[model samples]
Structure formats: structure tokens, C-alpha cells
Target: MSAEGSRAAQIKPFVRQALVCPVDKGPLLDAGDELYNPRLRVAYRIDADGIAVMLADEARKVDEAEHQRLTA
Candidate 1:
């Protein structure tokens, strides 16, 4: 591959590494089951067992403090 292409590939991880949650400025965690947004108190689960579920609104508010610490 070209030098520019290799350089771009190397930078991809760094670019993705720089992304942090807007709410808490903390790292987002992949809980295997889902991607939990602690600040928003939401857990986005995809393809769980056999169903795709989105935890939002009141359901997402179940563990606000726990999620915050997880993200932090």
C-alpha cells in the first residue's frame, strides 16, 4: 500500500480513541451485552439472545449512578 494509506490506517485507532461521551467526558464501555451510556442512563443492547432492544427513557433511568461510575 501507499505511504499515505498506511499513515491513514495508523491514525484511525487514535481518532476513535479520542472519542468520549459528551455527557460525562468519560470513556464509553462495551458491556458485551450492550453499549451503556451512563450519563444518559441508557443501555443500548443489540442482537441480544435473538432480539434487538433499546433501553431508553424511564427504563434507561434505572441505574443512573452506577452507569455514571461505569462510564467514569
Candidate 2:
């Protein structure tokens, strides 16, 4: 697997399962570089160290086109 894929998969299933959206407590999709919340149309960035930055204030709002790309 690629390095990025390995990094993304580093988060154990149990730990990943415990991560939820700060706004609605919905499940966050573990993308390689960020966690995506389709319901809220926002994304939480994952740092280079494979740490998800789950701060609500730090959430980057996704536009419709990007939202489609993410959810797709």
C-alpha cells in the first residue's frame, strides 16, 4: 500500500469508530488527509502526522461541488 494509505489506515478501527462529528455526532468518513462529514458539509483536516484535527472552529466548510466529490 502507498505511504498515505498506510498512514490513513493507522487509526485503529476501535479508535476510528469513536471519532464522530462535533456538530451532530454523526460518523466521520476517514479520508486519507481529512475526515469528511457529509451531513454537515464540512471536513476536519488530518495533519501530516495522521492526527485528525477535530476542532469545530477549524472545520473547513465544503462547497456543494466539493461536497459531492467527498460523498461520492
Scored by TM-score, the top model is 2
Which is the leading candidate under lDDT? 2
The 10-residue segment of model 2 with minimum total lDDT is 1-10
lDDT of 2 by residue, 1-72 (tens): 553475446777787788899889999876557888999888898787877788999999989999877677
Each model's C-alpha lDDT?
A: 0.47, 0.81
Q: Native-vs-model 2 lDDT?
A: 0.81
Tell me the lDDT of model 1 at 64. Answer: 57
Q: Which regions in candidate 1 have their CA more than 4 angstroms from the true location?
A: 1-27, 48-59, 64-72
Number of clashes in model 1? 0
**Candidate 1 — which pairs collide?**
none
Model 1 lDDT at residue 16: 34
- Candidate 1 on 16-71: residue-level lDDT in tens? 36645445656544444444565556654535242224334323443756665656
